[model samples]
Target chain A: MNSVFWTHLVKDLRIEWRSLDAIVSMLFFAGLVVVLFSLAFDPRAAVSQGIAGGVLCVATMFASVSALNQAWSREIRHQVMDAQRMTPSSGAQLYFAKVLVNFIFVTLVQIALAPFFFVMYNLHIAGPAWVLALILPLGTWALVCNGVFFAALSIRSRNRELLLSLILFPIFIPALLGMVQATTAVLTGDNDPWLWIKMLTGYDIIFTTVSLLLFDVVFHAE
Target chain B: MKKAAFTLFPLITILLMVWGYYQAIYVAPDDALQGYVFRIIYYHVPSASVAFCFFAVSLLGSIGYLAFRRSDPNKAQIADAWALAGAEVGVIFCTVVLTTGPLWGRRAWGIWWTWDARLTTTLVLWLIYMSYLLLRRFAAGPQMQTLAAVLGIFGALDVPIVYMSNRWWRTQHPAPVFGGGEGSGMKDPTMVHALLWNMLAWFCWGMLVLLLRYKVERRHQEYAELEAEEALASAD
Candidate 1:
């Protein structure tokens, strides 16, 4: 079971490593968003501090959509998903592997964006750096878990990219709010970062479990 | 008997709506704070409530469809019909709530919109279900129903979380205007009656619309099944 998970993960990683399609596009998109936002607002102003967290989360969310779609669309386009269905390995394993891969990809894009954000926005992290670090993965995990699940669900659709975003963004509001609020607290020197962290953790756990259990239904629905 | 029940529903709805409107405008006293603009509450509050109720129905139908899908295809079809009906009707009422809300807000809050907890949550709820309907429309295939059912369940699950997060976050909109704690709610019995009457009327009208929509969905499903069968026959 564990081997199955690792094999799938490695396969995806290798494909991404060779093509650099999803990661490069996501980074470029995130960079553009940061630049556009910087152009719109003077980073030296008070408003920048208030808007920074939201802008970062929004950029990540939009960029991750393309990455998530690519992750599933490649399998569907190549009939790889059908082949996997014939294998003895559980669908949940494949789901977990894809989710882990997506999480990593999103995290890397975010990491690449972080320095740009700091430079462009003239941002300062007032809270412990550890809080931002911890929040990054937890928040990204929550986003990508839902992203991958919905990507699979919408993979066979004609208008999947639009459909996936339409379905995902609304459901993503709570987690996005949590991440934005927590990041806001961290940047603005607010003391209650834990509240947002707890919310993010809870969001991640509930969504991951639900997505894992229901993935088989999505996979076998045809 | 079924036909009679169907015919009777529209009549009852019309009468209730007429009475409810009269009670709201003439019988119920104007609110001390907002005066006449508060009458919009009669429609706005009930529409929002009915919208939430329809979503609840959609959730139940989605669960039922998924649960019975393998064991009984017929039951699954019924569940799918109900889910479709609930979502369509829910979106309609949600539209009314969203529209009426801003109009009320324009007069009361002096702004057309606010990031108030209730308003934001309602907006999110509307988006989630609208996506559900859109998925059903465009994502054509045998798996569409199953996929839509999963989405329906997930959307419903997100509603409470959306509400909670918005509440914890700051809100610009007013707090619960009705059924809230002390200092909230109406004092006059007639106003209470008008509110309840409008709620009941809207619920009945919503159900009437839901039943009609369910019939349309049933017919659409039947047509699709027939087309598939004809295609298979021609291929053979």
Candidate 2:
């Protein structure tokens, strides 16, 4: 319970609460993607049920990237980065707070987009629904954790938006694989979902640790 | 003498490549099963081997850059040069492997691609390095090296997961051609010998290009430093 970490996290949450910018656009983008997916794919009950996981994960990914590219723009503006650099606290706290806040934002959009899964795709869970609680959060955390870090990494680039996705997507494939596979299994109830869930858990643990460790270096390197 | 060796290296590499081509095309005996088409392995496998090897070089260079950047900046710049050179050259070789792989696959497997672990992992590896190069190209400022090095390490971390994907799931990519468990997969001695020569030739050629690229990058770093100094001096 470091005060710095807690304060930073609360500040970001409060700021976003005031504007609702990240969540609003994320939800809208995700909703559109879900509908677009239905139009592109067969969308029959049988086909949709099987592909529901992939569509949901992919929609979340695209929507989150839209939000993530702007996650640090506020800090970059108004000399907030310079002020933050002068603080005695470690940079990891700020990085952690940003990830946590963006995670909450993306999760809110996923929640809002849930109804589309039912109304449009008619996706039914063949396996236990409880696993969705564990898997979706884990998947979203994985995306935000890496997404925020790479967004910062690419912030100074000319192709900042494109660079974020280019670097992030390849690194993210394994976790995406896990999320898609686990979700698909749950939707279909054919294969055991544990393997993919375990993989997601591993991915979250590895990248979260690395991002926290390297955050200071990236923060001060400028 | 140093200048002489620099010129001689490439000449030797070219001669070895010529010799390797002769051994591969004329001296080596054919595969009993697939016959002439199997010769692609000599070029294809060697190119892949070089790509993986140079990627390791790039990783080590990145680690070295981060290690020395704070304590010894001169050493860090040199290390960064190695990192860029290894990565760029590695990408070129990886491109060759990706192209030649499908060519071989089209003939051997009767398909251009599959989502098997090896093929998928190789594609992912290519994507990782390509992004690394892109970051180097697109990013600016003093922080660029630090960011690129961090990314290099992060990308390397994925390699193990990619390698293990085959074990966790069934893969259609053929098992290791040389070191699949109990014994060497190739039984024919001439084929092995020819493959060895080609491997040697490719390694020599790759080394030449890597060194050339490293020299170029080092010069670029020095020139950039001088220009920065000039700009600051003029500002003052």
Give each prediction's DockQ, rounded to 2 decimals.
0.86, 0.77
Residue by residue across A174-215, what tens digits does model 2's lDDT show? 888888888999989998989878888888999999999988
Chain A superposition TM-score, candidate 1? 0.97
Candidate 2 backbone clash number: 0
Residue A137, candidate 2: how far off, in angstroms? Answer: 1.3
Best by DockQ: 1
Query: Candidate 2 — which residues are off by over 4 angstroms?
Result: none
| Candidate number achieving the greatest lDDT relative to the actual structure | 1
Interface RMSD of each: 0.8, 1.0
Residue pairs with clashing backbones, model 2: none
TM of chain B, each: 0.95, 0.96
Assess the local accuracy of residue A131 in candidate 1 as a C-alpha lDDT between 0 and 100.
Answer: 86
**What is the C-alpha lDDT profile of model 1 across A93-116, one tens digit per residue?**
999999999889999999888887
Model 2 error, position A184 (Å)? 0.5
